[model samples]
Target: MDAPISWAEARTAMHEAGRQGARPAVAVPLSETDGTTLAAPLTSRTDVPAFPASAVDGWAVRGPQPWIPEGRVLAGERPPALTRPGTCMEIATGAMVPEGTEAIVRLECAHHEHGRITGVARARRDWREAGEEVSAGEELLPAGSPVTPAVIGLAASSGHDTLHVHRPPSAAVLVFGDELKTAGLPGLGRIRDSLGPSVPSWLRRLGALPVEGPAHPVADTLEDHLAALTSALKTADIVCTTGGTMHGPADHLHPALRELGAEYLVDTVAVRPGSPMLAARLPGGKFVCGLPGNPQAALTALMTLTEPLIAGLTRRPLPSLRTVPVAEETIGRGDFTHLAAARLDTHGRAHTLGHAASSMLRGVAAGDGFVVVSPGGVVDAGMHVPFLPLPLYAGEAPVAVRQEGVPAVPLPDQAHAHSTAPR
Candidate 1:
């Protein structure tokens, strides 16, 4: 068997695979492109502000102060040139300034006497020059950028009615454990199927459109596994299978992959709780990700492999890991990397959570994400460590508030709160 690869190596290999098989781009209207990835650079069709406009509700003075007041100009109206010397036009905010205009005198600062205006212009120009915000044909955003609400607004302001974006990849889940029950409570040594119901939600958060309907359990037999995989691959760009990742007696995932002529991109990762995870590229560029049966371990595998793959398929840049201080000492897994579930406090310190067993979900359920401890490395309190943020649903704010020049920490009100989910 091949040796387990590093967590970073696995992510990079899967991401490369997705990029090699990236989906084609399509032109979509701005209203329907919230979650898509831009396929082309977003360029400005015209200069931002388009023309010189007043930045304040004041007068557009031509040459000197003590100018005679002319007719008023509101926003969107064109005023005649200030050809007459010592003349000014009353201009509203965002109104285009006429030719030969020198400066703007704020309405409050202007002194009116004998129907003439007199005011000292501020040192800074009060009118926005043409192309002040963006020049014509300038690239606002590069290709592969995620289409966010702010991106949509920018596209609209840049004169784009429709944007060219890559379509979101689709995924399907297949639960492959006979001991897992699909409905009702666990009994008679049979456990309720958790991955079947939850994996799709995580996939959606990762920007993949999950196939419709609940995933049905696949029998432990090799025939059943092959059949389910074949059916799922027909529709989904990626198929995630739960359980049977290890080479145990009941594990048919490897055999099925071999039979399907799939090439292993990442056989396993040297990460605690998810070392049995695997990712492969099947014939024709479709992908299969094998996840351990343990709930938390499965999530770790999802983050380790599937997240980066989805990012590449959607043409988004790989998710960047941020550094956070650990509130307490964290033990590593000897030679293996440790992914410890942790929550962020208001001060941006990472507090490792208890009940973090591989089979348990409670630890991750209450935490923001995981803190990555390098192999054989013990992280002391106050030391900065790498952090992987949990996948978030569309429009949901991240658990950590990241402001420029500010520490990446949770807000006071959200210190102990989990990420908000849609009702």
Candidate 2:
């Protein structure tokens, strides 16, 4: 067999040729559309604020202090014109300004005695101007921008109750292993199904829909694997299979994919702990990613293949890689890239984690990001290296799991983890 390609080469090839996010845009309600990518440009249908409104609880004066008080204009009310510079109007927060008002006299500075306002500090408008936030026909955000809470607020302010956004991609995960148990601790040669519960969470963070039930754990038989693949393809845009990229008798990904008309885009990559991974494009513009059974190896494959795949499928931009200085020197492989779990310090420096074996996630769940060491690279202290980050909501602490069938693990808070790749 030909040697596996480099990690960078695999990423470039997949991105350059993967199906462009040509999925039709959907007009989703702003209430339920957080984290979606905007498919169409977000233009303001109406000017934000619509009309000039008071920014503070103050008096709307024509020009200066000691002006004649016109009347009270609370929020949601429009005041008539203050035709002369010597006149003033009592204006509340968010109230519309009179046409001829020159400035606002704040309640603190205005001396209100017998309904006559005075002591206007200066001649300045303290109200928001019409189209101050965004003007009508102005583009608030371009297509391909991720819809965040602030984005939704901006859309609402621009008179959009619904937004034209790229729909979230749906994915299916197939967990392949005979020795994997559905629950409980690993003992007596049977390990708990780690990927079944974890992969879906990872997928959701990448802007895919949440996996409803548990991940499908398939039997070792090839027929069973074929059935699972066929079923997942019918509903999912991408199917991720774990533990079958190798040539073991139980491994069935390569053979099943061939039978199912999948052409390999990435057979494997020259990366430590995840070199057995594979990726292919299936019929109907769908995709399949094969990950190793080891917990950390599966994570590596998720970042290496699944991350960019989801970005492309959902029409979001690929995450840009960042370089950071390491706290200590670490040895790296001579022939391939090595992704090691590491924790970031207060100053944004990286400290290597020791528990990054192929089978364990102790270091992964405890750390902030991975340090990508290049081929023949000697990582010295203060040397810069590429880093891939996980969504860090509250920074990964263990949670208690009481159910016998449930896996006890620490997961990031997906809602608060809105930013991608910590700087």
Candidate 3:
């Protein structure tokens, strides 16, 4: 940490390291493949809809005639041929339309009887055509596509039994400092280990499987640091360490990293409160990130820097954030940008929270998300400020359980949430 490195410079360095580490070849089962990357392009073995079907609970009618009910066709049941004009078959939602029908008039808009029907309205034009959703032999999903719930459902509906997906990366977290204690356990003159709980959760959110640790605390010695770092590096695709990257009296990561021939991508960034973050690539094609030990600072670095590096390494596309109006003012100035924890009110406005120190996890804990307040200027109320939505686990209090089994809550339509800023 000789001088603060510019954010742009840090990003470039991390990007380069990410590129060098990008040889993803992990595979996983379909049961655990949600959000995993596709190894090859997915083409349709059969058409979506598979047949000409009704889009609504309506009567299937032949072309160019007034509606008349000939028979009833329930869903998944076939009907006889339409051999005469003005013949309409009652069809339920998702039922296959008769071979000669071109339009569907909903039951509400048509007059019906036991064996005959009439008086269909002119406005009932809701008919679903065959192959409208997917073609018979087209590419439904391209190779390298991340498997989402929608993609998996589509693939299953289109007759796929299994899919090839990139596996989650193995992550090893190492904590340095003999003074640290296991969470919730107390020892005299020792602090609880903050990085242990937080880092594993973050890695899990990034589609990585965190390897639980021996939780070794390195003394302020070069040999001690090297031994711990070497053990973690050998077992993980990525190794992240806490506390030792700093230049303070206890810092030993710099020397330990050098001993392992770790290439420095960026040792520091020009952002407030979390600039001491470091990214490096080990010689054996693994990544090692040195994160600050303060709870909030390390969390910010994970979201802003390490998350993107993980995405690049896994070949997953990073999400783009959009600008939203600020509900309050933010003060800062410089060439670098700041990711501040804030609440996005219901009306798409960002309200700044006061607790922003590197050690203050309360701001993030209470807020709905973070606002990316640029250092170039002060953002006023109603001004569009870019920000990121924190993970569902973060920015909220722990959930409670009732006596009975808790009902599953439906997720909100994230596509329409307007209060977010793009990455």
**Top-lDDT candidate index:** 1
Order of models, best TM-score first = 2, 1, 3
TM-score of 2: 0.87
Estimate TM-scores for all models: 0.83, 0.87, 0.76
lDDT of 3 at 193: 78
Model 1, range 328-367, lDDT digits (tens) per residue? 9998887677899999999888999999999999899999
**lDDT per residue (tens digit) for residues 1-423 in model 3:** 456676545554565556456675654555666757676677777877787777788777875555666788877887787767778888888887887775777778776556556555456456566677887778887665667677778877776778766665678887788788876676788888778877888787665668876655567688888887788877788887777768788888998888999887777776766778887788888888888888777876776567667666666555345465787777653545676788877877778787888877878888866666555656666767556666554212112111135332211112212233231
Q: In angstroms, how far off is 92's CA in candidate 3?
A: 5.2
lDDT of 1: 0.84
Give a tens-digit lDDT track for model 2, residues 295-380.
99998998888877776766765555656678998667667788889998988789999888999899998897788776666677
lDDT of 2 at 262: 85
Query: Residue 349 CA error for candidate 1 (Å)?
Result: 2.3
Worst 10 residues of 3 by lDDT: 394-403
Question: Which prediction has more favorable TM-score, 2 or 3?
Answer: 2
Which 10 successive residues of model 1 have the least lDDT summed? 414-423
Name the lDDT value of residue 348 in candidate 1: 81
